[model samples]
Target chain A: MYRQGWLGWLFVAPALLLTCVFFLWPLALVGWMSLHNWPLIGRIRWIGIANYRAMLNDPIFLQSVRFTLTYAAAITPTIFVVAMALALLANGDRRFVGLFRTLWFMPTAIGLSTASVLWVWMLNGQVGIFAAIGRALGLVETDIPYLDSGTNAMIAACSMVVWKTAGFNMVLLLVGLQSIPSELHEAARIDGAGAWQNFRHVTLPLMRRTLKLALFLSITGSLLAFDQFYIITRGGPQNGTISMVYWIYNNAFSSFRTGYAAALSLVLLAVVLLASLAQFMLFRDREDA
Target chain B: MSRNTAAWLYYAACLAVTGVFVFPVLWVLICSLRPAAESALPPAWIPSTLSLENYETLRRVGAGLWRYVGNSVAVSVGSALAVAAVAALAAFGFSRFRFAGRGVAFVLLLAAIMVPFQTVLTPLFIVLRAVGLHNTLLGLGIVYTTFHLPLAIFLMLTAMGAVPRTLDEAAMLDGAGALTVLLRVILPLVAPSLATVVLINFIAGWNEFLAALILMTDQSNYTLPVMLVTVTFGYMGTVDWGALQAATVLTMLPVLALTLCFQRYYVQGLVAGATKG
Candidate 1:
């Protein structure tokens, strides 16, 4: 290590300064903004928790929270299961495994908003592929409107999310899967363990840490989803698909309710921290058991 | 079943799965190449006729296609370079120095990774506005660099730490200064990681949508993703499917090119980050 006393401080000065100005300072400023009646272009008035109190009575915000939780509940498991399966399929150094990995992981390169726009077009009732297939298979007499109804929009958005993110988790899990020693699987096979039995007893038990990390990532990602809902549904059909981030964006930018948005941001941050804490507790308990 | 037949079946299953994922992108490419009329009709796997009308339409859309592309390229490349440069310095400091508060500062920096950007948008906006950078591309690039630092710094620290300290000590013995040693000796050793950090941050800046959308409100200042959104609602709420498809393909091109070229570094970075965390 270098003993160049204050030179070390100089090296880290830029990073520390940027982080404080952009990230840490914003965090502190948002807290202060939450306690006032700050608007887009007006004097800041101190309201002293009025925004927080108003959240209790705001129906749209409450619905947004519920709707976001529901989306997270549904999407997290879907991504996890699909990603785990892909990881298992592409785990070994087989002849075609690399090809499979690339193909699955390719979609992850596209931006979420672009992906949503593509899905919006593909799910269009009139000129969409889904409707065309449905007609070709004699499934429906006319085009199926995928984004008009709330349920359908949710389904389409979830499908898009799965397609966009499953590959990323697949890669993460693939790393974990490869870390397990191959000899353990061989021993299981020698002990007359079938594939299912080997996976159940050997793989799952060894994969707890990776699974925990992947699950946490998936949950937080789902909770913060905004672009897909904004592009696909635009919080329409009675705001059924309004996510927490989407609601926050609307209040902050669209409605120009800066103070209210700041309050909501704090609440969202608290919710995420709580979720992380819960996951940590759950994983720790399992590890101890 | 015979083992050979079982292997064949497995390959077939894998092929089918690949098709499921690749079909959407391939279909979009085909749609982009087909004539405008064919795109509006019922979907066809095979294009009866190929034309560049969609590309033509894409070029004519809001503020022109090349303008948005320029904006995206500028912002992503600028921020990626900024991230790599800043992270290199921070990594060196944290790795090579035994000064006071180094441990605490490192921990605090990594903790910034947990605070997602969504939670800080309002204040970030206000801060940018206060600094007169609210709607500028340079401002957006700086924001991207700041967000990418925590992870980049962490990764760079590990990369530099793995280098034997003896090499730098030898350089110092020969009257080499700290800056000279870092630039000439240590950086060459960590080139692979530098590439990885650049690729990760570039892809991240390219794919970012919400921040760009909220921050760049002017039509001309829109990046590719935000521009794609505007084109979707083109021509009186009726989407120009051909132009939209063409534009989407264009947006995906640079990222796909980078990933395919440096896939080893890309995957390595991801695995290292996940495992270490």
Candidate 2:
């Protein structure tokens, strides 16, 4: 590092100032707001932990917490598996590898909301292709209600997310795979190691950091999922699809219970931080082992 | 198996995977191209008719399709450029300097990554409204730029580190100031990294929904993603599938084009950001 003295601070001032004003300040404000009865437009009154206490009994909020966990639990592993398979398939330089990579990564380029909208059309009962295929396969008497039921809505939303994001994780994993020098594989081959063994011994160990990062992003993203559920399911089928963030949004905007929403937001943040911390520990523990 | 058979088998496996990823997009494109009446027919790999009626319908939405398109483009591009400039400076400082509390500041910046912005939406909305920027495109762009800083700074720092110190040192010896060296001597060498930063930010800002949905309340101020949501659920709680498909295609077009053009840098940013974390 150069000894640039105060010049260094000048260079970093804009970034630091923006972060402080936009991110850190809001973060502190959220903490403060959670302690008050802050409505969208009303007199603010300090209520201590009333919002937090109310959250424990708020049936919708509790259900949202559960549903969000269920959705994240279901989607995170699914994306990781599909992305890993794609990375393995498209990792190396072969014919049309670039074509395949681009194809897989294409959906991710589209916004999640746009992808969700497309899926909304794709899952429509009358004109949806999925329903048409279901009929052609004799799977249903007519257009299956893909979004009408809670289980099916979960499935459709999860599938749409996998389609949208798996390729991104695939690219991250592919980079990790490629960064493992080809010579290691050659050395493993010279030792008569089989493909599975080579991957297990050489690849998995070396790819741990990338795996952790990808999984961290996937889990946190799934935890905060809102647009897909909001646009496609609209927290419908009797509110079975309500996510944590969705509930927070409803409280903050729909009900104008800004303080309650702020409290819920803090809880979500705690859960996400804990989840990521757990992942970091789990990966590092494996490294030690 | 013979080598030829192995190659064909490999191709077959890849083709199958590609079908799963590509068919949805192709199907969407086909559906978007079909006449609004024909869209109700059963799924067809081939469209019997082609029309732009659905796209034309998109123009009937509030402030028209072009308005939202322009809004999204302006916000995303503006935010991307702003982020690149700010992040380039921060990366330069962090990578090239020794200063008091530098490590602490870096940690604070990275901490933003850990806290998902969704959690802070309420306070952020309040803050923006207090500052009279809640419903404005500039506020949205500022939010995007602020959130993008950590990753952009990280990527730039890595890129700047890869450039030899001797290059900048030579410029310094010629009596060039630090900012001058950064602008004239260092930035040109890291153009690819700069592109990566811009593309990443642009795609993210263009597609960002939750913040935009929360912050932008006016129909006229809606970004494309928010507008799409309104078009989907806002019309007496009914979805006009054709218009939605057409709109989706329009939204994806710029992102896909940029990704294809900048695939190398885009992929580099993804991998570098992940591995660095």
Candidate 3:
């Protein structure tokens, strides 16, 4: 297998070339663009960190950060709790568990933008099924403006994200649950442990790494959320629901501030990297203990 | 409760949860079939007269519906194949050979997985434009293949690592060249993982929004996800809910079918990718 050096290079050359051109080159260019007044068309000029300076005082940028974090906070726990429950229910070798797993995990296949469109109809005040049901059941005399206000809009977006993504987490956590040796649970039962006690002691500790990975992905995804807010709410109700990526998108595409958007993108990358690094360190230490 | 009663309760609970998860898609499917005139308030759970009229209207309204679907299929399949071939080669290299700077290169590749696409949008746009691939489907396919390489390579690496080296050595002793061994011997053994890579990459490419949005500004080249957003938002004044729902169903049909058909491998690949990352 280790016969020749050039053969290994030949095997890896295509990947390396593609990555260098697509990934590393663009990454380096992002850093370079952040320090310039790059635009869609026209002359590029060096600005020396002015874009970064402007971001500190940009209210929309700050607001987008706040909303993104708030969205992540709201959505991650919701996904985890629901996913954990779904995983437990679908864990064992029970009847019809395969069907239950498929049904629960089907939404992940649908695109985010597509899900947003479907939710728009579902949460519509006028012709939506939910609204129709509510009116028929005497819950409200009038339609509920589910996406008209900031609070309700955020809630609507969060719910759509959870609905589309919780299934993915459920599958991930199910793998973790399945990987846990049955002997641990059997031992707990031998000590007369009830369901709650066994789950609390044996299942929880064993699934720690999987839970951390799931939470990490969910939080990162929620922070980078753009399509849901963009399609569902359009950052409406006074730009209250604009996630950070959406904000960057507006700056780059709508406003044509490529340099400023590049700066914002770097800041976001830093935040995500730092947060992930912290989570990894925290989990690693706990695992060792 | 008796054991029989407890079993019944669990079954009921599982059914209820499954209903909650799947009801929205079902509702969308129903809405897609309902005629526009009857699609208004107090929506019918069961349409009085279900028809393909909404789908026809969607085709007429979104004149580019078929083109978008074609673009999506082309891009998804093209990128999936490109990623599989490139990643399999790279994974073989990493898993088999003791090359110089292999560890550093692998780590750098892994680091690319963490870098969000937003950060590279501007620069990549400029580069693609310079290369005369600004809005072409090939340009989009290349970008997708490149972006997906890291995870694809990681998954393939794991798949190849599990293969015993003796097989490769035996193949070599039988006069099979390195490329021949990779293409015939090793690849056949890891065909399942290759399929998984293709499926995962197809979904990612199919669902990709921002890249497709920025790269393919031309409507004719828009992927399904981008086209749906554009058509829905572009003609904001004349929003057709029934047609929109129909288009969404149409857009989701391929990925949904793929997932249902290959769910076992999909889940395994997803879990492997996530845990390894």
- State each candidate's clash count: 0, 0, 0
> What are the lDDT figures for the candidates, one per model?
0.88, 0.89, 0.87
CAPRI band of model 2? medium
Off by over 4 Å in 1: A282-289
B141-231 per-residue lDDT for model 1 (tens digits): 9899999999899889888989999999999999999989899999999999999999988998998999998899788899999999888
Give lDDT tens digits, candidate 3, residues B181-253: 8999999999999999999999989999888998888878888888788767747575677777888889888
Candidate 1, residue A89: lDDT: 88
In angstroms, what RMSD does candidate 3 have relative to the true structure?
Answer: 1.6
How far in Å is the alpha carbon of A174 misplaced in model 3?
A: 1.6
CAPRI level of candidate 3: medium
What TM-score would each prediction reach against the true structure?
Answer: 0.97, 0.94, 0.97
Residue pairs that clash (backbone atoms under 3 angstroms), model 1:
none
DockQ by candidate, in order: 0.74, 0.73, 0.73
Per-residue error for A96 in candidate 2, Å, reads 1.9
Worst 10 residues of 2 chain A by lDDT: A280-289
Which of candidates 1 and 3 reaches a greater lDDT? Answer: 1
lDDT of 1: 0.88
